[model samples]
Target: MKVGVISDTHGLLRPEALAALEGCALIVHAGDIGKPEVLEALAALAPLRVVRGNNDLALLWAQGLPDVDRFEVQGWQVLLVHDLADVPAHLDQGVQWVITGHSHKPLIERREGCLYLNPGSAGPRRFSLPVTLALIEVGADALVPEIVPLLAANPLKATSR
Candidate 1:
């Protein structure tokens, strides 16, 4: 299963970001969505799993969003949260992957037995940070991750994984 992971859109869903997410079987948004239309746009692409961000707390449209979420995808146990700091001190043993946003820095790492991923900020450029998202290929035996940069020199073209 191919899953597109994105976060911190902050209301700007760049065409490049959307294009990078194409062909994904599922989409996960970590937070700071900025507007209802962002969710609408993402949902239109594929089944979406999302959590509310700190910035979304004051917005009425985001009131119903959960602070965190946990579920199974392609037989993998996954946990989603907007900020890593808020993650429970005792994470569930069954969770093999932890997805988080807020810092807008793309990351993929493994610690203990769990994989931690942050798809970064696909939104407006923040300082000198690269605008990016991520893709995860879940298979029967392993999970593969790829980071896609949205504002590369070519723009809209994703690096081949």
Candidate 2:
């Protein structure tokens, strides 16, 4: 199964992000999805799972949203949330992948056979962080991840001056 992981979309969903997420069986929005339209747009592309972030509290629609989410994909346990720091300790549910976004920095790390992924800020450009997202192929056994930067994914943009 192909899964697209994205976060910190503070109301902006760029075409580059959409294009990169194409063909994904599921899309995980970690948090900071500024508007309902952003969710709608992602839902249009694929089945979407989302969590509420700090910035999302003001919106009425986010009042009932959960702070954390858990899912099983391709026999691997996946946990989704906005901030990694909020992940509970000492309570184990066999989680294999921890997907969270808050710092606006793309990251991929593996420890003790579990993967920690942050797709970064796919929304409006933030500070100096690159606009990026992640694509993961969860097969019968292995989980392969690819971090795709918006600039490289945007086909219309020129790479050279």
Candidate 3:
């Protein structure tokens, strides 16, 4: 299964981001979603699983925010969390893939037989960092995670004042 992963969209959901995610079997938003409409937009494309970010108010997003989520896709046990620090406590949960977002920097690495992925920040540009996301391909035995750089959503030039 192909799942589109994104996070830190501080209210801006670029057309390019949406276009890049089209036709994915599922979409996972790690956090910092500026508005509920962000989830709504993604749901229109496919089934969505989202976690509450540090900036997201539970009351404001009572219907959408989830602290932690665990699900199986294509035979891979996937765990979703907003912060990486919260991972160690749950590391023993038997999840093959752990996904999180907070720093807005895309990362893909395998440690101790588990895959860790951060789709980066797909929202407004954070400093000079490039807007990014991720694509996860789950197979019968292993999970392949790719850090997808959002070329069209470069915030460096757009945010220059």
Candidate 4:
């Protein structure tokens, strides 16, 4: 199963991001969506799972939207959260991956026995950071994820000398 991971959009959705997420079975929004339309747009692509971030507190989320959620996909347990600090110490239910987005920096790390992923800020650029997103593919026995950066669709050209 292919899962698209994104976060910290802050209301700007790029067509590149949408294209990268096409054909994904599920889309995970880490937070800071900025508006309901963001989710609506993603829902058009695939089933979406979301967590309310600090910036999203003012928005209305579905009932029982918790700080963390455990999702089982293809027999692998994946944990979804907005903040890494909120991670539970023990995984009694068996978690293979921990997905979170808060710092707006894309990350793919395998710590201990689990994977930690952050799709970064795919919306308006923050500081000097590049816009990026991630795709996670869970095979029957293993999980593979890739972080991809979104480049400007049009690059500036140099003036004639």
TM-score of model 2 (CA atoms): 0.91
The superposed Cα distance between candidate 2 and the true structure at residue 27, in angstroms, equals: 0.5
lDDT of each: 0.89, 0.85, 0.82, 0.82
Per-residue lDDT tens digits for candidate 3, residues 90-131, read: 475678788999999888877777788889999999888878
Which regions of candidate 3 fall more than 4 Å away from where they truly are?
Answer: 152-161
Please state the error at residue 156 of candidate 4 in Å.
24
Error of 2 at 94 (Å): 1.0
Cα-based TM-score, every candidate: 0.93, 0.91, 0.88, 0.88
lDDT of 2 by residue, 42-140 (tens): 999999899989899899988888899998898988888899898776336688888999999888887676788888889888898788988888887
How does candidate 3 score on lDDT? 0.82
The candidate scoring highest on TM-score is 1
Please rank every candidate by TM-score, starting with the best. Answer: 1, 2, 3, 4
lDDT by residue (5-122, candidate 4, tens digit) is 9999988889999998999999999987887888899999999988878788876653345667788888888898888887787754688888898898888887777888888898
**Candidate 1's residue-wise lDDT over 1-161, tens digit each?**
89999999999999998898999999999999999999999999999999999999999999999999999988888999999898777788888889999999888888677888899899989988999998988886688888888877432222211
lDDT of 1 at 130: 90
Better of 1 and 4 by TM-score: 1
TM-score of 4: 0.88
Clashing pairs in 4: none
Model 2: how far is 151 from its true place, Å? 1.8
C-alpha RMSD for every candidate:
3.3, 5.4, 6.4, 7.6
